[model samples]
Target chain A: MEQTTIRFTLNDRPITHAAMPYRTLLEVLRDDLGLTGSKEGCGTGDCGACTLLLDGKPVTSCLVLAAEADGRKVTTVEGLAKDGKLTPVQVAFIRYGGLQCGICTSGFIVAAHALLESNKTPSEADVRAAIGGNLCRCTGYDKIVRAILAAAYDEGELVDESASMPVMEKPLFTEGPM
Target chain B: MRSFKYYAATSWEDAVAMLSKNAAAQVIAGGSDLLGWIKDDLNGPGAPRADLLIDIRTIPNTSYVKFDAAGGLKLGALTPLVTVAESADVLKNYPGLAKSALSPASPAIRNVGSIAGNLMQRPRCWYLRGKDFACYKKGGDFCFAVTGENQYHAILEGELCYIVHPSDTAPALIALNASAKVVGPGGAKDVALDKFFIGPRTNVLKETVLEHNELLAEISVPAPAANWKSAFIKVTQRDVYDFAVVSVAVAGQIEGGVWKDGRVVLGGVAPTPYRATAAEDALKGQKIDEKSARNAGDLTLVKARPMSQNAYKVDIAKNLIARAVLSLASA
Candidate 1:
């Protein structure tokens, strides 16, 4: 198969690269871009180590083709720190003991960030729903959920119980670079 | 995975044209199933590595779901399982369909998997999907599931092949009397959901009745009856990403406190989605009480011939049928 050039915003900077058509998004990010925070626990979509933000929504990068990420903004764990300051989710992860081996931390943070960006104040159930895709074998999920909750509370937008909620609109899924 | 020539279709017409022109071409939409098959090197019996791939994701108008004014649902073939599970109209009128799509697989798989791809996915039999076994599902002359670890094998129709339909949404759709619109080089045509599968004796190479060049265009679901209630129950070893041991989809209308028009379907027990006609007959014209439901469940499993390790599936199917029927009765 002929390789195709893919253009996307990685972390905060725009990147353009040529890759094989069948390579996974996980492989491209870790190999071509040298961003290895996204681990490959399972080549299939079962393990969420390869989770990343494509256009600000969390998805399993392993299942997605690299060619599918064309013209999209891709975020990885390397992008979480700004000006040497840890992002709020990252800080909460440290303070709340959300890491053990730290392998799953990147994917969990990405998943939590995507969840909180749309839902300012999500309930425990909502947090669980959001991060259900990300699995952590070392640390039980209690601390992870707690860390996300702490971040949400510091952000100071509590869930309003009386208001009716609407389903958030999702981003359009497009084919990635092949 | 073997390297293949990749062509991204800007439109459905282009995809159909490419498929018609190349016999070795495979349609890839989500790759939730295809990639696994390729990486595992288990491409079904007589099926080789796809030499050419037609990426169906770029096809216009193939990723949306809409409802028409005539009380029918039109689902484009590439609509994601997550979207189908979360659709308002789908949840309202066809909750069973939503439940089936949402039941198994991780949230990420649901997000990436397309309904059409799931329907076209190869069998989940360990020998078929596994990389180690070279059985009849992988072009071998003998089926290993007959003597190998037959736990997940079929119980009802274990012919030369012991595959269970891998689509989490197919049984529920069949229960709702859905039809598929397939477009090929010969043009578009529709096929009923029940008649879609080809068994071991029929065609071992293909799962569905679709022609080589045919691409599923849309899935059309007929209107439900006025007093209908439906439910889908799947039983598997794990709550996530596992194929069903036995599943049940029940849709029925209750009129005058008696079950009227109804359809009962079973999954994971046959090559294709199996209808429980005897069970449906037992409930028709009768009030769906606990006794009748149990009887119906029993009737559904009367002829089950489980393989060496899957005999437990019969009881599981019976229990699931009763549970599904009772839920419908209560609703």
Candidate 2:
């Protein structure tokens, strides 16, 4: 049960942590490094909610040991944007209603980003195959697939107005005594 | 998961030495299969714990897919399944291998699952996998699948245990006449893929013939003949990301549009990848037609002894064998 120091690049920054040998990359990222973008729907590899880029390829971080990422580059969902500007996939998700409830949003964005980076013009089948590992319960995947296709075809300009509705000012439980 | 000491082996010799010295240690390359077993606690509470894990993924020269005139097609033990499925040489020469590699699990799992790890994966029998049941595979007195749910149990070769080998690529490898290069403290040795798998009668505790101290170094597949055609067909409950209920792989040389010689291997049917030698013999001099393909299918399943609930698998296996052979014949 000894802890070992592992040095790896995370979110474009170098990080070193003393972690147990059995600690998964998902655990180290969420617990140790405070990068909780990647969610663990299933600790096993069945659910791809823990998907992240390991040296540019998407893999379930929950199944990957932290030590395996030593000296390697890992990119989580938080690393998708730069300088406060969202990536095309992220913007398209907002413009196309790619998510609901938002539990599996980060994984979908990361996976779609990796796919678009490799394939500029992914067909509907290609997009489906790319995100085949990721599972989303609420959105039913239609909006998510369309969002990715929109991003691939640079059609983010056709924004869905309901996706960015303004928040109300008043709180629902105003001054109610408990 | 239980804690274990981890060592990143830099060379093949060091990895083998580590395994040889520690009998309870296990090698982790890709770790897709081992981690799942560890999480599920398949090793019983009283069983010996895995004290050491030799991480061999860092070792150089152990992750390449090379093809040469002397070696034919060599896949390093650590080569990823996706790499094997996507390799141009593998796709062109050994389409059955490509199909098998691509058939298992999903894209993400294939991205990290190693070829050796796939071959070494344990059976997916729920009775053996779950902690509640004590099947014969876990050293119990009886196998629950014999009279239990028995739907997914083996039908062809279920003497003591009915656990089917869960690997998709293994059948294709066997049909292609591949050999595994194993290294241990003694030295290196080559084992045929057909003989690599050990049945429950041979050793009820393990799957492959790999000793605890040995490491599968590489898998080398013989080059197909000039007119060789190959195909793999798998029937699964779900279209994607599910294990095969019945799978068949066919590889043979077709001369003048007639079948000459070939190997037909069935997966998800028995303890090992079941090679249909009788079916192969049936197709030796026959033309690749519907009648001949159906005859090969019938001959393949002639000896299948189906369980109470798994009688349907026999028919499924036969149909898959026919479809696989017919596809190869027309290729």
Candidate 3:
């Protein structure tokens, strides 16, 4: 097999590796670099479980050859966090129950993060279209939609101060109500 | 996948020379389709494995979409499909082409798939792609679709093989009067997009007229008329990540609510993009209305020969043709 030395940036770190011509980026990331967060649901591009950010755009790593990643920057699901803090999309996934079985969570989070970076306030249709490539058999996409919508709002915006008090202390009904 | 030597061609001349020297080499652009085929082991028995893969994605100056008054639109072969789908010029002038680019597959595939690679990709017929069946397209004696499962087979031009052309952009380009610039050892030549594809009868082994060493360098679409309007409608099983069951591309001039000089091309129904000449003629000089659109659509598939399992495609093709033409006319 023919081997070539390729240099690129992986998760903000510059790295070099020897790769065969036929190896895909998915293999290099999972087997060679130990960045296995990007799972491979389908070897084809139909299932976007292996989605990653290549130069700030989401693409199927399974469809992309490792040679094509030479001299490029790759951001996997593992690189989405910074300073030990979870990204908004990740936090929203937990609060809104955006994942079940967890196999498709990484791809969905990465795709949603890319969407939020480009458009902070995306409509329901826009969110659906943005993640149209991804498949989640467990969640049925309702929670995923809610999670993305919640992620769009600021953390302070989601808190309701009026609802913080106990229900028994508040009036059962308004004065004007029958 | 089989082991192969990879070469990144820096220039057009270098790429052509490398291709001419190695008979077993294949040029790869996006590798969106090629890699899947390679993994599926579609290269049948006795067929030499692709010994070399010439990576053309790194070639500079060959990944642009330029538009000029004289040239209309010139798209480098290595230009990604997403670029074409998102280009403002394409969306404004050639809306059908833009819609075609955005209609098929998912965003991930469109992000990396090249326009030229989409045009040159092979059929998606199950029999031809499967390992067990050595159908006619794979140089076998019989076409399994003639008696086997063929819901997605061609309905118009199927003789030796029943594989449908699996390209959404080819019909749109043909409707827009496009041509491909090809380079090889003999030099460069411009071939019209209409003539680019070859039927199964012409050569069962290949879908296009491109020789082993020839490379599709760029695609050029002529400028449209002053009142040009276009639309593309694809009928698929699902909303996303599915190939067209039957797609229609319509481009023409609508002057004062009257349609003229129309071009209609149907995909996923023939070995090549089927140009509905009779339908185009029927649509010419007709007033923009649903009735006229229906008549034109009926005329388009007057001579369609549908297989046993794919008869529904004729109706789908007709409906899409009418819908596309009417929508473009009203736009």
TM-score of chain B of 1: 0.96
Is 1 or 2 the stronger prediction by lDDT? 2
User: What iRMS does model 3 reach?
Assistant: 1.2
TM-scores, each model vs. reference = 0.91, 0.94, 0.94
Candidate 2 residues B60-126, lDDT tens each?
8888889865558999999999999999999988988998998878677888899998898888888
Candidate 2 Cα deviation (angstroms), residue A57: 0.3
Alpha carbon lDDT of residue B156, candidate 2?
86
Question: Candidate 2: which stretches are off by over 4 Å?
Answer: A155-178, B44-48
In the range B65-164, model 1's lDDT, one tens digit per residue, is: 7875476888889998888998998999999998998865766677778888878888877777777667775777888888889888788876888887
Error of 1 at B139 (Å): 1.3
RMSD of each: 7.6, 5.6, 4.6
Tens digits of per-residue lDDT for model 3 on B208-246? 999888999999999877998888889999877789899
* lDDT over C-alpha atoms for residue B292 of model 1: 92
Candidate 1, which segments miss by more than 4 Å at Cα? Answer: A81-84, A120-125, A154-178, B43-46
In order, what DockQ does each candidate have?
A: 0.32, 0.57, 0.61
> Candidates 1 and 3: which is better by TM-score?
3
Model 3 chain B lowest lDDT segment of ten: B40-49
CA lDDT of every candidate:
0.81, 0.85, 0.86
Number of the top-ranking candidate, with DockQ as the measure: 3
lDDT by residue (tens digit), candidate 3, A77-127:
999988666777787777667898999899999889888888978998889
